[model samples]
Target: MARLNMRRCPQSRNPSSEKIIDFYAGDYEVNDSPIEQVKLTVPITDNPSEPVLTFRTWVLGLTSCALLAFLNRFFSFRQNPLSVGPVAAQIIVLPIGRLMASTLPTKVYQCPLTKWRFSLNPGPFSVKEHALITIFAGCGAGGVYAVHIVIILKAFYKRSLHPVAALLLAQTTQLLGYGWAGLFRKVLVDSPYMWWPQNLPQVSLFRALHEEQERPRGGVSRLQFFIIILVSSFAYYTVPGYLFPSLSALSFICWIWTDSVTMQQIGSGLNGLGIGSFGLDWSTVASFLSSPLAFPLFAIVNMLIGFILVIYVMLPIAYWTNIYDAKRFPIFSCETFDYSGQVYNVSRILNQKTFDLDVGAYNSYSRVYVSVLFALNYGLSFAGLVASLSHVALFDGKHIWQTWGNAKSESEEFGDVHTRLMKKYYDPVPHWWFHACLITSIVFSLIACEGFDKALQLPWWGFLLSVAVSFIFTLPVSVITATTNQAPGLNVITEMIIGYLYPGRPIANVTFKTYGTISTNQAISFLSDLKLGHYMKIPPKSMFIVQLAGTIVASSFCFGTAWWLLESVENICDKNLLPEGSPWTCPGDDVFYSASIIWGVVGPGRMFTSAGNYPEMNWFFLIGLLLPVPGWYLARKFPTTKWLGKIHWPIILGATSKMPPTRAVHFWSWGAVGLFFNYYIFRKYKTWWARHTYILSAALDAGLAFMGVFLYFALQGNNIEGPHWWGNSNGDHCPLATCPTSPGIKVEGCPVF
Candidate 1:
């Protein structure tokens, strides 16, 4: 219950003024150390005549985007999903660009009417073109999220959804955020204080790629260092990525107590508390939580505190106390359960004709339940959402207010160096263009949701409501992401609202949640990319075009790949009909389907109200609302204690928000690496940390991505499985970690009593 590490003192100065003050251990050219480093990575120079959106950029960008989309869609279903981000394309396309520059004919070509001219190959692939292509490929790196609705509807619900309807749904959801992105440009992108910490690594990588080979101060150059680590990481990943999978998480406690189910449950990294667990795989270390090296020291520290409080402390207490019959379910699971700890049969409570919940069948069957871990995550998420708003209002209110007041009157007066340079050189993307995109998307979203057969189930009013919520939440969420590299979302809250308003309408509820949540998230993503472009001095109009084009291309490729797999592959996502050890399990979609049932069909009234098992869980909202009070008071009381304001409650609570999909080992390993690089190296060897930390992160990602894709096509796709051995089997060597501890529960793979 004690959330803050507080030392109460006499109230003196205003907390609001004290919040922005900080003391630095080392000298900084600017108030922000990270932004000062931006001068090092991002060049202050600009070449106005460089060819951007050239023939090479268009062709390579399109090809890379399509390929990345296909791979993400295809590989996402496997046991260990391989996400080939734009980083690989950024590295791979360089040599190809060089070759094209040297080989292709340089004959000039002109458009029929306009002064626009092009060639088969641009002179040399300038860093601008390289950045554009990489940004374009980024459009499809993770695959479209809205495709999940199509998945549950067809695969799980067995409903016949037309391909055109599916296509419309995908495109609209993905494109709905352009307006929001445009509107927030002044606040999120143009301002100097909104330094997006996440995009720094990508900027660093681009600079390293263009830097000539030269070892500064008798040390390896950035280019040489990247090559060395890239090769080493590629070679090392073979052990955990293929040859031996258990190296991902070495559950030493489970290894020591081989026969004890309790011990395994207490120690397993993948499914349990991860008491003595460790990992060697880069994928395991950085998969769920992204590369730890990319995050700043303050953010990492906040996340670690949150992770420890939730995973190691509260999770154990909740389980051991047997609260809400915790012993009857697995230590960590997203699956809903019944009284006897059996997986709830969702079909049993559904009305076949109307696709609504059957009240009669529901009365006969048992009430639903989630694991203690899942329940806690939901509560913490509730807290995280409000705390973010409160934290931002208290800490960042003044800067945001000032930005809003004079953001347009005079750009040069209030802007930073990057903003000044951008404004002086390039024509800004007109505000009206963004307004048109927003309005048009809203009009089209209505048609898409309610147009064809009315299949999407979301009404016009509901879609408008979703937009309202998205509009309201974007600024706060963006502020959180812009500063701390963490985005607090409204996903859970959106579902809860719709589930209460219109219960037993699964598709409608999910559709509302998707638009409400992802619009904000997508806008934030676009903003991040824009900030990357800002740092690198890519023209705003060109960046805008690439983002739009990449989104359209990515959507098409995702739907095409998914539809093809659904048709050609036999019994996809059906484990019962597939051969032994088949990898098309659809774990993510299963979780999505469960959400539809819990918040859609079952409704929060029956599940989290008086009729439900966990009515008290709603109290988390109030708990989260007030969690930031103590920290603010302390900051105000002791203005000189600079670190007091750094206790970001939102980030700490949101740290473990992704726990079900992510395991305890993810945090443990991420923190381990982050401490070494961001904390220890950052303070001890600032220069080395600055040069090599981001290089190490980029190299690791690029190496694993290339190797993972190569392994899939070269080996796994051919049914050439890893050798049959102990190291390749039984992850974490903790088979019984998922077993329920209750006697006579009769759950599969558990003890009888």
Candidate 2:
């Protein structure tokens, strides 16, 4: 390789420091706005000789991976689950990395036979090395989506799955995404337009961790600021975490109207519209949607609009009017219902042997009806998926098309300054590696489906179709996730598709959905981390290797942890059987089970048809399909209506996607905090926003994580419940929120209207 015209880092950070970029002076200049902003945050420099996959990197990296996998998977069983992502607290770990670097021997030795060399401690822990470790952490930190299949099947449905099948399912679904990530990395990772807003926070934290910056006079440095906020977050979490858990959701209206069922239903943030309801706890503010401080302002606005429209405007009207017999059930719940205003007993309708729906039993018992909120979520999901596709195709189609062509030709020097540096110094990960991964995953998927008593019930063709659907939707869904920090899930679409085709097989429906949706989800996760690597200047192959290795380790641990818990903890997911205040309620798994009942046992054919109550929900598909068109035209028509261009229908419609586990208060508090930081604070204090915003997010996440783990082990783990009084008794002092409104309907604890 010859010495290239790659621009070196200038001594000063200035716009005029950029030099010799030929392509940007031409047609692609339109996309440079976002790329330019990225330059403001990511340093346009690289140190290629730094040893990335060293002894400290692997040991610390894999240790973090295994522990996080165990912690995340273990905590997920709790009613209010806590998930700590691997991206948090790079700054906090700087000392540990340094300690290992200092203590370990610096001796380099040759292998006994082969021409191989190794070292216990390489040079100083470089930025590249630390970034690589985080990548490994990230791969293990996330819960394996396939494990959800295992839990719901075994725990909820009481079905047995072969261990081999479960392991294969976990790995295939996870690795399938690797292929997609590699394919799209050129456009998604390398391209500046796909800025991947989520990565910027991690990037900010990385720079703060590794780079040395002189403290401003009379002002704290980034490191000092991070320490202060992290400690504050740590101390504050104890109040809500253990001492007074109800502080998590403080709805003043609920406090004011203790006796009124209607008022409580409207006021309860845990299960209602959450009007003027918010939280004092950082966990509550960040629940389901990590820290809202990282959410982009445009995303915050769009999601807020969608959330309000659904929760306040649409739901109140429907629930009050008894639409879908809403008054008979909780205003906000994942529970399915019968016509007599009772919870639907799915066991009575399912065949014990086949685990399929017994038609006669189902018909004789009652039609399955979800709450008004659940019904609307279904409708909105139908809209959100297509809305994403339409929005992406309409807004970003031309750029994607050009990028695809450029990637194929293999001659386009298409990337911002970061991509140019990577291309100049390191070997790009070969496309064949990802192709091999895709092929292997597909082959193993077939084996898992067929080799084990046909337990999965999905045919070979069904598996192929699921792959195609995932492939088709990955680009659009990923585009949405990249820009907005939220992606509409493919689970609903996949379940809906398989339900109609292969009805009465609940296991099969979930399996199909798992394969289709999880693969796409994993692909997006991989691409996000890759973009982080892109910004940090880690070699692409090293990142890929760590991701794959960490994924393998994490998948095994998630499966093993889940398997052990299921065996040891009797009556684990059974809420009625478990003792009061037991954290092992498996709330998210309950939602997954409810979905199985709706789409698999009863099936969409029966539930989403004219004979069913939710026939109108199907119309959302068309509504969402066309939702993006008007925005595109109006933005073009009114050139000066700049905000119109930013109004993304996909994000707006999918804003409430995480609702069942994530209640109105979660969105309410998250959106408020999001706007305060990303919008108001950002515009008012640009430099501070860039420097401290993401650091604050990391602090809250890390602080909450460390405290939650401590609380569980030191107190809750020993069956020693903290002091329980009025302040800690209930989430919002609103018992009647779960009550039914119909005259004769009776439910436990809820007032009868």
Candidate 3:
């Protein structure tokens, strides 16, 4: 079973003690021959030799797609309808694809499949395979959170599509960048200066594949990887579930004295001894905190902005309005619209009502709520967008031109190299074919999307509107995603923009009015392109097909699974019934929706959108918007800083905004996945097989999520509608529940005591 190994060198240091195992066991080297150096160069399309290479492309494509799909699913974080499927494209999939490609003779061309004789071997896999894997992984990883999207689909599109299908369809929208990523990779990745922190895994994996055949052998390292997988799998599968149930909620433990202690000292108080460990997946707090990696830079600037906005801006305004008793908290929910019946219950009101309020609502004077701040933020963000764009062009025009110019040079060379590489190491799928496939897919989706009884039928006008908005925002959205990988509060902004621009139309209701908008197919295709540019190293022309194929596969499977989970598992989305204190609950909705509304209506203005109102986004957005400039300015200002200097700002800001200092588990988990793997598993062991650990982790998580969902059912006596674990309080005064029960009653584990 062990494919690679090693023995100690004769160095005098400690002979046996210095057990240096060869990590690059399966890699090949170009030094094998002069011809090998040029193996990647295919003949021009018009040349007689073109046919040979075309076939080879087919084989590589097919193989790469299949293996990647399997691995992506195998290593995914959650089997939920919306999880990002794979950890790294190049690390696991590309290496395996390259290994398979190595077996062919340098001169070989297309596979024997006569159906498409002129086509290259299609490589071992099609672009479809890779795209499908990537899209599904991303959606599966993140989709579960947006279950309401599925609910909308099922409630509206029941005839033609089920709830699960609707959920997948809604989720697929997030992947839209993949389709156009190839066209924009030059703007995103090829720029030597743009490291794209998130895409690092892709770079590593692709580079490994480009290595030559017979470079060296290190089987022992592979064996070590195998051992680690088994050990980790056993530990994760058994220990976390049975041996130490406490570990399941470890995130609470890690924050006990730190985050909780501070809260308690402030008189917020704690319910019990929290687990407080670094990483038990406490969705409630995790959603609010910046990601561990994006915290460092974000924290400093964000804290400054947060202090200014909360203390000086919103707090002062709040005090003057008397929205709260002496406490600095809001009197009502900033998430909802209606605030009529429960004026006395301040906490309940604050958790449920819309935050789009006039200053009068802030006053104890009792003013009717109005969307005053919302309009201001909406206006400002539009201004910010224009200003941001102009600033970029003004500041980075030369850099942009220079980057594109270099890309032009590389582009020409890439064509030849791509052709040859297709023959040698990959499969080439033509752009035209992919385009045709996409068109056909659109037509098919439109028909299926119409739904029975027209439950999910989109008005012709709304359909046109979504398409227009999608297209208009496509490039800009891609730019933001490629660089920052975040666009928080933007969706709410988009909704408001759309709502205002095209007044009185329920575009959100387009799930039924026009299922086409959220069908997941188009987005999957788009995300595939983004991924192709980031990872696979496939040429832009090739990405079209790659994304198209992936969309078809994922859309088919994802939708089905979503319908099953939602219909069978009742109230998973019910704010009160779901995980208590979790971000999935009603209160957490305040954070996301309020931020979006604030940004959407206020448009980054002084009241709702600026550093004074929403400091996190205002600071993070500004930093991200100015990253290219600072990166360039710093490069010039401190010429010596290079990676350390220009990068320090973006990385620090990104790390801070996304990752906070308090999140040790997030730090450790990422450190293990990104840093540890790169440094130890990828470096010390030197075998791509070590990548299996990611797959092992994903598989374990998927199983756990599935079991968790099932156990939830079991605990409720097979009643899917039963109360949730952890925060239900068994009917006791449930914190922030819609029905305000007294502290004495016991509803389940959620008791009033």
Candidate 4:
């Protein structure tokens, strides 16, 4: 309970500071630098005495968390899963903060017993308090991906779980990441070079909102522009989102050739590759790929190149060429199939008593078949894994080593201006605090893994091993993400390890992967938020408290929402059980369940090794490792070729990161928007790009999220249908999108009432 005195650094005499030197000097030159020149010149203060844990922060933070958790979980069940990102929370909470600041009682009120006296108003809603609210909302924004485990069990696998047990599973998995974030705060948050490039926009938005004294020369101020965009986006969403739903996926090609199976496969957004498709909906554009308007131009270009090469060029060639008789299946799908082109009957292959695979039944059912695109996704994942390691080593090893070597130095010369400013104000959260959380998290995980039937059958040693793996990979992943805005996930690695260690236990495999991979990802994300706090000068202790509280609140809401959806949505995952063209297809759960089968039930040995049917996929790891070598060598040999240095293999491989749930058209559309703004607009109007890009993104996201929630409750949630029309009908547009061209495969059609 130690309080640190916060102080602002004296403003430098130079009004226009052009250059600021730091230890990682060249790292930012390639992409958007976290410590921009504009930020250094601005006079900002870190006020540590500001009330951050006041009633306003808690009320607004919890409310935002509850709403975001519920909405994100609800959307996850949809065919096109969308998430309410942290940026949305960051933007929406600003007005709420201002409202609280204006209406709350100014007089101090004392607690009944404790010596705590705090004002509900807390004097003008400090930036730290606003950030604390965002941190809480962020904890709930994505609604704990691990909760899908319980959902998949109950909804897809027909194994019901106790609500309390489900909540604990979600809470423990999420909080484990917080422990890792706490442990790595020094390396990932305190370090000057750990900029976490994605967080720059949020930081920029914070400064624009709180720091600006007078309106700029531009006709519209940032705040005014943001509000306008938010209102405009919200109004526009009603058309594509609910009324004229066809606008969400406008495929002109499908309209032209409605009966052509080939065209439908290439053009349909809902069922196929979505080649010529376009969405009027901003939410559709940003759903899986994220807001492209926020990405750096160079990164977007690299991803686009890779996406086109893989999905458009390579996948089609492989499918049409009948690689693995791929023509027998749909060109793009996550569902597993039998060799006879029928949906794979998982229940038939599983033992009735023990959830293990029945050898005789499995042999009789024939080898499980995967769509070519699905198999290729695994290959790309393998490539991405090795490519990330090699790319980071070749490009970032020197800077990482240098930063580590100078870790003990408190010299301002080695740190960014923000880091130096922070040093003057607040002390970093104590390491013991992180260790305590880590120990507690481990205890909870052990109890869950051992005590609950719904929980995994993972041993204590296995749980520790997952944590150890997370620790080992955290630094490298953090470094990559901090610099380039990309982190190759630990999913494949974790699943492979656990699959080898404990085969035939699908629950244990997924649980281990959840703890190992998701924890690392969540830790990096939390650290990124902390770095944002550092830049904004939020007290470390307050950030910690809000994050922990938010995670707990999010867990409860997400679990409850998921449970409610499962109970109401009949035959959630089974297409045969639901009405045709129902939006509630559970694609995310399909992908998750498919992974469980591939890695957990069948085991990695049978999927990638010589014993497996698809042994050729093992070559991708070597290919990924070697892919970056030539680029690195060329950059070293000819240093002047700037483009060579920017050829990031990890970004290229990451283009296929979410293939199942995300279509090729999502990348195409995202790349187009990124090109329009990040590439063209950024070069033409740097100031406008800096000022408006993130605000625009935040506004659009907030609008979409809020409208989606409203529409769901007003119409979909209550089972109240809008007026029936072609525009409002299931917007597939193309009946033959999922029809198989290969002989002996059954053809499908859209519902025509």
**Comparison by TM-score, 2 against 4, better one:** 2
Q: Residue by residue across 542-641, what tens digits does model 2's lDDT show? A: 8888888888988988888888898888888988889877878987888888898999999998888997889999999999999999999999899899
Clashing residue pair totals per candidate (backbone < 3 A):
0, 0, 151, 0
Candidate 1: regions farther than 4 A off: 1-34
lDDT of each: 0.83, 0.82, 0.35, 0.75
Instruction: Give the root-mean-square deviation of each candidate in angstroms.
Output: 8.0, 3.4, 11.0, 4.8
TM-score, each model? 0.94, 0.95, 0.54, 0.91
In Å, residue 348's CA in model 1 sits off its true spot by 0.2
Off by over 4 Å in 3: 1-84, 87-147, 152-179, 185-223, 242-245, 248-262, 265-277, 280-400, 403-489, 502-546, 565-572, 575-635, 643-753
Clashing pairs in 4: none
Top candidate when judged by TM-score against the true structure: 2
TM-score of model number 1: 0.94
Model 4: what TM-score? 0.91
Q: Return the number of clashes found in candidate 3.
A: 151
- Residue-level lDDT of model 3, residues 1-753, one tens digit each, is 223445443321211122333222343212111121112111111111212223333444444344433332322212111122243332244444445445544443444756433322324533333433443344333322233344433332221344433543443343333433434445544443333334333222222233222322453332243335434543453333333333323433323334332222121111211112233432222223323222223223323343233323543354345331212222113332322322222222221223222333334322222222222233334434443353445445566677677666755332222233333433434444534543443444354345433333344455445545554444443343344433322343344444444322221333321232232223433543444443333444445544455444444444445455446554534455566533222223233334323333222332333323333334434544554565556567776654523132222322322211122233334333334443455456533423333333333333444434334434422443333454322111112222112233333322242
* Residue 691 displacement in candidate 4 (angstroms): 1.9
Query: Lowest summed lDDT over 10 consecutive residues: which window, candidate 3?
Result: 36-45
**Model 2 accuracy (lDDT, Cα):** 0.82
